[model samples]
Target: MPDSVLVAYGTTNGSTARIAEAVAEVLRRDGLAVEARPARSVTSVTPYDAVVVGGGLYTGRWHKDARRFVRRHRRALAERPLWLFSSGPLDASASERDIPPVAGVRKAMDRLDARDHVTFGGCLEEGAKGWVARMILRSGKGGDFRDFAAVEAWASRVGAELVGEWERSR
Candidate 1:
């Protein structure tokens, strides 16, 4: 197994959590010890050698808890390698060229000095959403458009990076 890795994520309706689990699976398959947990579940960053932080987007903002987590552990995160990702942009057709960084994400990238940052498409369930979220879904503004293949590919890249880091340290 490779060095311990923490895959922490924040979700609104659970899409981000699903993405985090998928990422953790990819790392595990690559032989890394990975732990996937919600932002609130993480009491400290002292155990993990590397961290991957993810969150869902709402109104051009990441979940507040995620932002706070990063801010709280910025020092520990900076000492180790850290990556950030966001699940947003409802339109599946929009490529990376079409989607610019959301303000919150951009700010976090700077604050965390993240090694990498990515944006993934998110999911919207019309039937399961609350009034406000359902309205957003019904308005045709948000939809379930996550690209699992891309997510997997990115996870592979992360795995590669972790392996490389492990090798270098030895």
Candidate 2:
């Protein structure tokens, strides 16, 4: 049977979802069954061999839904391979440390024993954000800052790791 992965994400302006889809596509191409969706839409993680959770970053935090998802499924997630990512940097060139995953979720990541946590670049659309969000984005960053090539490289690495690990276990 093919290995299956669940890629769940939370996005306020949709950039994180796009990143999640890219990750899922790379996993699918690597011959894994992949289910990509918003965090709210996922009710369970037990059906898959592995799980990936990602979210948009805001005010140095991940969207609430993504955090809640991890909290709710903490036990189930702990039993399987779990990976995390956060997309919030408006500068595609920013290093992951400069746009780290919400520090608050470290407990959840630890409980789930996540294999990896990545910080990817994000995108901001014109006028799609509220005043606060706009103001935040305007603090010297805007436009589509997502680096598809970089995202793809990370996803490819993830895919290879998952495949190799599964094979070794089998």
Candidate 3:
């Protein structure tokens, strides 16, 4: 395994970016070199040992830039360990439903043999949304429902895996 990790994310309201930062922090604490950047900022995946892709859901789809990034770098990503995550489902309750993975992401997953895919709770600010999204948020049905503990724990696990891989490569 390589000593570098990249946490690339796409966010609209910025929640997914926070999640990506948290993951990167945990990995950094594990003594690995990690860089977190927006998906659009990543020109290539060639320099990373492993990649973690994250994006927020908008109208049941991931941000377009994220989808495009993955597609463009799918071949390079396939040669490395890859993990995918999404910020969706307003709360833990929403996780119970069988929401299909975003179509573009599903295609990427097939190509990358992604080691893991996760869906975490998302958020929508009161006035930060468009009319339709605002209406949904105003309905009292949506909330900032991220479970930071769960997010941290998952990151720790991934860090452990990266550490193991790094040691073996040595």
Task: TM-score winner between 1 and 3, please give it.
Answer: 1
Cα lDDT computed for each candidate against the true fold: 0.84, 0.83, 0.84
Candidate 2 lDDT tens digits, 1-170? 33689999988888899999999999899989999989999988888888999988887888888999999888899988888988877775554445445676666787778988888887887775678678865775676877877778888998988888878878
List CA RMSD, all candidates: 1.8, 2.0, 2.0
**Pairs in steric clash, model 3:** none
For TM-score, the strongest prediction is 1
> Can you list the residue pairs that collide in candidate 1?
none
lDDT per residue (tens digit) for residues 1-170 in model 1? 34699999988789899999999999999999999999978989999999999988888888777888888888898888788888877887534544555787788788778888888898888664568688877788877788888888889998998898778978
C-alpha lDDT of candidate 2 relative to the true structure: 0.83
User: TM-score for every candidate vs. truth?
Assistant: 0.91, 0.90, 0.90
Roughly what TM-score does model 1 have, to 2 decimal places? Answer: 0.91
The per-residue C-alpha lDDT of model 1 at residue 108 equals: 73
